[model samples]
Target: MKKQTRAIASTLIFAMLLGVTACSKKNSNKSKKKFSVATQAETTEAPSETTESTTESTTETTTETTTEATSNPLGLKIDVPQENCEIQFLPEEERFKYDMVLELNEADHTVGGHVVVNFYNNSSEEWNQLCMRDYSSLFKEAHHDGFQEIEVKEGALTEVTNVMNETTSQALTCNRDADVSVLWIPLDQNLKPGEHMTLSYDFKATIPLVADRYGLSDGVYNVTNFYPILAVYEDGKGFSHEAYYNFGECFYSEISNYHVTLTLPEKMKLLSTGVENTPANADGKNTYTIEAPCVRDFVFCASENFKFFEDDYDGIHIRLVYDEAHPCGDTMDACAEASLQAAKDSFAAFNKAFGKYPYPEVDIVLAPIDAGGMEYPNLIICTVDAMYCLTNSYESFPYEQMAIVVAHELGHQWFMGIVGNNSGMEPWLDESFASYTEFVFYEYLGVEDEMELYSRETFDLTKEPWLTSMQANGILPINRSFYDFEDADSYILAAYSYGKIALYQMEEILGREAFHGILREYVHRNAFTNSTSSRFFGVLLECAGQDNADLNKLIEVLFDI
Candidate 1:
């Protein structure tokens, strides 16, 4: 992901909502004293018991076919184990499930919805209360980004009703943090590990007129993070609650199932995270039913004036929603077509390099967003200016750069989408690796010039404001929280820029096939799990075989482990 601003001339996509996996095997070649394996976040943690997820997704990538395919899809020349379901989950347990019925009022830019979430205690920690992140509540006032001023009025969640825990048939008290964004609802009974609970609530929010990830602008609504979501619970940490920052993607979540029924005004084209079953239009409203399984978050964007384009490649349906509301329609047309083609090419490249995108369909919305691109489960929001230079009309950003944006966002499908993480704490797990996938996309297509160009994008990070302080402190740490950076540019530099180069450096040491094989193993082992840094390094050291000083030094230098 890149960071672009509200305007096109200042096109610096360094605002990439950068978004990781590790494998379990043996200790790294580096001795116990050499690497901080004991302090690694994933060492003592994993989600639930080993249970087969009843995924609605069409992807069926078996370990046998993925690792031992005769065609050598992943050029690794090593033998790998054939095992699935690495994480823990009980057979009777249910994956997190959210059932929502929402209605979008275009005239007032308001949405009224009721959500019923059914979930179990997957962690070892017992739950006396539930913690949730109400992102909409974070926008209580206006925000300024030096370049753009977002004037917000009544942008918060104005109304909430019927917060209940259905398990005990008890109405619950919804407590709020100081910011009023994190909700602490008292559970009627203690939710022990493996115990289930059902929560129901109704909410309403007025969408502010902002062109960012979670607002409405130019008649299009970016309805992301508009509802309260379950905050991930760490074993000893209770509920993970990082303050919402003005920069980077700080949202973290567990993979869950979504069944959303949305009602929209007539002619509103909906682009959402899950696949749509069908729609019934009646009484000037269109009601759509969608089912998304094993997804981190559920979001949807709607535009009544979108010029839509679609195509199918290898049974995966691709849709491109172009905002016709943009001033440069004819010029945007060429860029739109290019982006659609980029999506197809990106899917093909990533499917080969990583793993098959499990969802049957993927939607790329070309909207007027502040950032270059933001990713969801099956949908990606790209800046309409992503491909074209608005000021110069036909003259566009290098075609390869546009393709890289699409590829980077799609790469999140593997990093943040398939494998989960606490993004607020470890942005690079997704962002930097997505940046690496940008190189892999180009490399897979044999486009060395483009690969060289993309690799150079992360160069020269010392000039960023955050790096100077880091150098002064004598450490170059990539494991930074959203609040740790000096600004958006500094965060972008570290997470998106320097982090990718770190991976490239590792690839240089590990060899492409060996690294790719490790990645394949990582995905095969940790898919749908919140992967940790130590686990990733452990896999790398294990694959590099008993003696990889270069890999250890790189991790030490980049992450200060």
Candidate 2:
């Protein structure tokens, strides 16, 4: 979630943190597709009824009563489990499963999918109806994300039809929200707690021709958030409500397992969130089998004219899929090399600073995307075309704009991918942390002058041209929801620019060693679970010292939290 306006000069690097022990062995490999590096565990919760406000029931005014925890008398979202491990996965019986079979039509830019979602009622209340987010409908409108170049011409939705209960073999009916992306499917029977229900449905998605995350640009197809995903259910509230906002990410879901078999044109190269097995070609079609366990969401970016460049770091294979022929220039090779090195640096730094990345592969897609960059689970799409690619090495780099974007997206691997959060509500939890990792990138790489320049402007919010006003504007600055922001510029200022500065100031308050150590603990405790900005504050105060009210005062002064 990088701001598109990052063309700062990159000369100096701060050798602040101690150098990590990294041994690189270069090998010219084509993806070298590796699979099954992470353990399969954990499932996510369903949704409950809540308003469209930024303050949901989960993160509310708990000042009157402490949060339910032993160490966390504040009752924060993160509570140290009795048996904490590197991977705290939910039991298989409690985990949800999505078995999908899809066929991609390259000619039509449409995907015909048959999805079977096996849901387990883990909540205290019985589920009467199921909810999902139809993000594809957002693309059909006349407008799109402000920064993105859009062409929305009608074909963007597929009503969830042929929904049948796999357990009882009963046909189902659904209700669609005309205004928002929320879809409500009334259940025939009440799915009680400890009960397992299997429902299958048929859907067809039309990939609009746009330079956005979920669209068809040139020959490349960015298929993301395109499915009818189950909304997270709260305990007291009904299914959580999240409308599609063009400003920031509004996706919220539980960690689940995906077993998918996709049939597409053989010429298209695929890069997805999971470990993909080699495809079998038949009748000019490539049918690939992919599996991703304990992931929040599944996405893939496919194209017919993608060239491959690859390298391996820390046993994880890194693949660079670039389309340099159409719309993209020839400097893609240089961008790939720089982007791969940044990926390696990101893995090393986040491994030491937070925790080890729990995946076998990472894919970097350098296409002609509109915005800065977008991050999925294992794949990241960065738009580095013509005037974009700064031909330079990572060590003595002059302009490190590409590396900053790549590092920010990779930072989501830890914040958004590994540790989950409600992006619509508390975007600062993920976007700002991702932005803060940019500083960690320079700090780890010892980009002293570059770090100084970036940190200076980031700390001074008025310097950013997008932030039109220095006033608070009556809205909760960093703590507000996506719907709260009037425009994209204000959202970027709060989530991207100001949020990272707050964390950096936190590091300055507590020495770097303590700060990094606390983050490592935070990720381990909250891995595969959703976190809140308040919980982050509680963790900081819990680790540093609750006696110090400096953080409380800082939030009041800076972000008006």
Candidate 3:
């Protein structure tokens, strides 16, 4: 398996690699709404000593006004503690190490607690910061008022393995758009350039009863916004996170080591974020071990019954697990295979088109959730039943539906996974592209007019002028946009309809060879780095050269802001 892949370039992206499996339960919907908290008493020595040492640690409460710009996406919020927080994690547990570790410098203090951030180098030489919306629900109903400031003597590193006092809760008590005080800890710790360090923290998250957009249904974990993952930090061009909350986009993160240990009921088998290192074991309980390096955040889905189907593609081991009892089993399998094939095809194409596949394994699962599909690094979770309903109008699985959905999910390997976009903002970047590619599977299979038919089906949804560029009807970010969709319909429209149309148009103007050549060049250059629509257009325009007026016009109509 070519696991040494480069960083993806899109801001609108799914979390790290996603794995797929099916579980049988009343409500298989995974929990998306969650809140985490971890607490710790400082034991590590301060880097510096100050007169404040004589004062009671908990007695002082610093006050400062917090000003935050409204986020385009309405749901989440990101706040970083100014005081340097020492983050921690180990290989033994499942959840992340901590909420944050704060080393307060009287000179570099923040309003309250500093937000803990984990960074990763997708493919770039430097690490980028991720951006998130504010979730102030953490502030209210807290056992601890705020953080206890510790003086880090100049040049000394103070480590506080902080944990959240509140482990479970959904939706911030604060409004989604509300601005709250947050502390930011700079990764630019005075350490020399190119230096790496571990920032760990612990947090307790409550699975919300109703995860408005992303949360728990019944007891299953359909989680996404469980913790305060880091936000992208910009040099000057605003946040590296995307501007519009479109269906797909690129994201940035700081590179750091992740050692997550989650403690849960022994009856549960955890299908988590990265590849598994330790086999499931019983110590009066059952647990699986995982170790991922340079991951931004950890995500896991635990279910009692995970029907695992394992296979290998190009010598790379792939596992597809899901609930056998699901109504859409036959369709799911077909889609799964198609998706797998598409992924392999995309990888092969990328090698010729762009580069090589990065990781050793790719996992695809069928979540019992309502939303159709979600993509992570090597894993992707797609709602099989919903997928069946969205594209396969027939009650049964048709070869075409299987091919299209599978191809779409597989397309994520390039558009979303390898390219890396912020799914929260630029929904179209990867979705549309992936959709277009998904239909290409038909062409590959020698289906008649498959691309045209697929394009027509997709465009039919957004053909209305109101749907283009209008906030109410225009595409929304992947993360928040799912709300607007009832099933898998939106994905088809975004990925195949708009994205395919645009890509096909480009190919027409540039010639298939030249159009594909531009893609190859763009992917090769970006490899693992995060990118945006503008960047893609720039590269394509350059590849197409100045002689192509049609290409230029198409670029303007489709991508010009």
lDDT of each: 0.68, 0.68, 0.40
- Winner of 1 and 2 under TM-score: 1
lDDT of 3 by residue, 3-67 (tens): 10122212112211110111011013321110000001112223113212311221121111221
Q: Encode model 1's per-residue lDDT on 144-250: one tens digit a residue.
A: 63333556765765466799988888999888888667888888889999898999999887787788777888888888888888999899888988877645676
User: What RMSD, rounded to one decimal, does every model reach?
Assistant: 10.3, 10.5, 18.6
lDDT of 2 by residue, 512-535 (tens): 656776687677667778887777
Q: How high is each candidate's TM-score?
A: 0.83, 0.81, 0.58
Our model 2 lands, by Cα RMSD against the true structure, at 10.5
Off by over 4 Å in 2: 2-90, 144-150, 389-399, 449-470, 473-476, 558-561
Candidate 2: residue 515 Cα off by (Å):
0.9
Q: Could you tell which candidate, 1 or 2, scores higher by lDDT? A: 1
The TM-score-based order of candidates, best leading, equals: 1, 2, 3
Residue 393 of model 3 has an lDDT of 31
